[model samples]
Target: MKYLVMVQGSQADYDALGGKASAHSPAWSEKELRAMSSFMEELNNDLAESGEMVDGNGLAAPAATRLVGLGEDGRPVITDGPYGETKELLAGYWVLDCESLERVTEIAERVLRAPAPEGSPVYPVVIRPIPDAGGGDV
Candidate 1:
């Protein structure tokens, strides 16, 4: 089965980088940033070796995002992100082809160990099955 594991962030986290395009900037101290980067690299490599990883990437900040949807009369509507009243922004995601939901959840728990600023609260990781093209959930 294929599952998507998502990491959430806050608007302030993006703002700390000054702009959405500066998403890769070191928002934490050098030590912390390096540790987090190393952890992610190791994790990705392990997943690859295990033949579980499909694709993964850190996304640009929410400020650089655009929301597109159908408006009344089926017209296209567009809006910028940093969406009002949103408590968390999607920071990154990993798509994994794993054996079970429990296994994916375990991987997400490991992701929770990713570094964060001291005193920061534990962020939620969303784990959901990716639906298949035949109109069935994978």
Candidate 2:
């Protein structure tokens, strides 16, 4: 089965994540930064070797996002960025092809253990099996 693991972050705490630049920013000390990078690389390599990794990517900062909506008058309302509650922003995600939900859970546990800067709160990840949208057993 294929599963998509969403890395979710609360909008209220989004700004505290140092914004999107932190994804590639050198905000942490050299030692800490290096450790994080190494850890991520090792994790990717391990996943690739295990053949469970289908695709994954980190997202840009929310500030860079744009939202489009329609007003009650049927006029197109353009927004600068994500709308609604920031608490529901999807930070990033991974699509994994696993044999069972148990396997996906195992992978998620390992990912949750990944290194983050000190004092940063751990983000909760949502794991859901991807339903086959084709005309199959619904």
Q: Give the number of the best model, judged by TM-score.
A: 1
Off by over 4 Å in 2: 10-27, 82-84, 135-138
Alpha-carbon lDDT, every model? 0.82, 0.71
For model 2, the local distance difference test gives 0.71
Residue pairs with backbone overlap in model 1: none
List where candidate 1 sits over 4 angstroms from the true fold: 17-27, 71-74, 134-138
Per-residue CA lDDT of model 1 for 93-136, tens digit only, reads 99999999999999999999987656554688999899887888
State the lDDT of candidate 2 residue by residue for 18-132, as single tens digits. Answer: 4332432323455655776687678778878999888988787566678888999999887875555554578778898899989899888987887766566577779988877
Q: How many backbone clashes does candidate 1 have?
A: 0
